[model samples]
Target: MRAEFFIKSFCRIENGQVMFNGNTIFTTESEIFSNFSKETYRHFEISYPKFFKMDNLSKLAFLAAEIILKNENLDADKNNIALVFSNRASSLDTDRKHQKSIENSGSIFPSPAVFVYTLPNICLGEISIRHRLYSENSFFIFEKFNAEHLQLYAHNLLRTKKAEKVLCGWVEFDGDDYKAFLYLVEKNAEIPHTVQKIESLYYNE
Candidate 1:
């Protein structure tokens, strides 16, 4: 039998608020990472101290994942869950910061803490560590949001038994511009996982 997938829950973080399932959970005047991310983190009562050390990209992805997976039973068959994420800017937000640190005359040393999150996949690692998920994961870079690509890959992962559930979306952070639209996909839910549906949910927000 072919596998059927449905969207379990979705969250969108943009326009100075974090919207989950069509309701705003967090709002702030500051949309920049330094101020907005911290506010949202505190609003959610997240105790992860390491959150401060993460770069903007990781912070955005982590917070979005936290909201979606908050009430999920992640420990049960954790390896059966997959994380598939995409972004247009890759890690340029942090990459530029790392570059400036290296090029600065006062500080010529590259910080390992900052260097660690230079890859876009680092966010996936952060989420995996938090949920103890040792499953298939991938990060893609696209010119823009590509729902077709996301739908195809996620559905293939589930249909091929690579994963039972998939956490997928676009998390892009470049300077003051950032957005995270993440959703959970599972077998047989009310929201069918379709290309048009994903695109609609993403752009309509």
Candidate 2:
């Protein structure tokens, strides 16, 4: 059977606020990733200690994923769910940090912790590990948000039965400016997975 995809739920994090399905559930006055992310994590009551250790890029993605998947009741065989994520910044935010750690220091020491997240896909791995999902994952870089590319790729994954559901969208963190718009796509739901619809949700200020 040809599968039809729908958005099960969506979450957006920007302007120091976290919104899920059009409702703002959390907010902070601090914009710094260190303070804002920690405050947001505490507000959500997330117990993941590793969240503190992650780079800004991963923390932004991880917190958004937490809100998107909060109410989901997944079974052991979650390999059917895939993560399809894209961002314009790639890993530049972390890459800068890693570079500074070596270049600014007299001893020229690079922290392995910061270096690990130099790849944009590392956030996907963090989400997969947290949820224990062993499914396909892909990360794409674009000059800006490409709704058509995301919609087409996610729909194809479902249509081909490569993934029963997909968590897809944009998660970008460069410097202190950060935004994440993530949605859970499934076989059937109220919101059809159309390019226009995804773009609307993404650009929905």
Candidate 3:
């Protein structure tokens, strides 16, 4: 028999606001992602110094994951929890910054710090380090939020016993625009981890 999976909880971040399980958690007047992220970090009193140095992609994903993960009793399953993330912009936001450093004809200096996050998966690393999740992790780039793929992937991971729970969502950031929808998948919850359900929750206002 196949094992069933459920969405235990979820969080969203966009337009200078943050929401967890459909409730408003934080709001800010700062439109710039950089400023808004910092405001949220302080608001939540998250004590991670490396958060400030992360690129926008990492910051956004990390915050959404942090909120959704913190609420759940993940202490026992921390090591067994897997991460599955998708994004439309990939690492373009940070890629642009890295490009600028080398693009300048007058000064051709590439920063190792900026260059480190050229790949989209770096955000996964940030989340993993923050929550100490040491399990399967994957980042996919899609033209849009592919709920079906995410649902299927989580199902396989859970049914196969590869993960006790899965943290999956779409987190996109480009220039000054950004959006994140992170949810935790486990064997128990009110809602089934279906593609339709994932789509509805992602679009839920």
lDDT of 3 by residue, 1-205 (tens): 4437888999999999999888998999997887899999999999999998998899999999989878866674446889999998899988888889888734555688998999999999998887788889999999999999999999899889998999999999998789999999999888788888899999993
* TM-score of every candidate relative to the true structure: 0.94, 0.94, 0.94
Candidate 1 displacement at residue 150 in angstroms: 0.8
| Superposed Cα deviation of residue 123, candidate 2 (Å) | 0.2
Please name the candidate that would achieve the greatest lDDT relative to the true structure: 3
Query: In model 1, which regions exceed 4 Å deviation?
Result: 1-3, 76-79, 105-109
> Model 1 residue 62 lDDT?
95
Q: Give the alpha carbon lDDT tens digit for every residue of 1-205 in model 1.
A: 4437899899999878999987888899994568999999999999999889888899999999999998785665555789999999999998998898888735655688888888999999998887788889999999999999989999899889998889999999998899999999988778888888899899863
**Which pairs clash (backbone N, Cα, C closer than 3 Å) in model 2?**
none
Candidate 1 whole-model C-alpha lDDT, 0 to 1: 0.89
lDDT of each: 0.89, 0.89, 0.90
| TM value for model 3 | 0.94
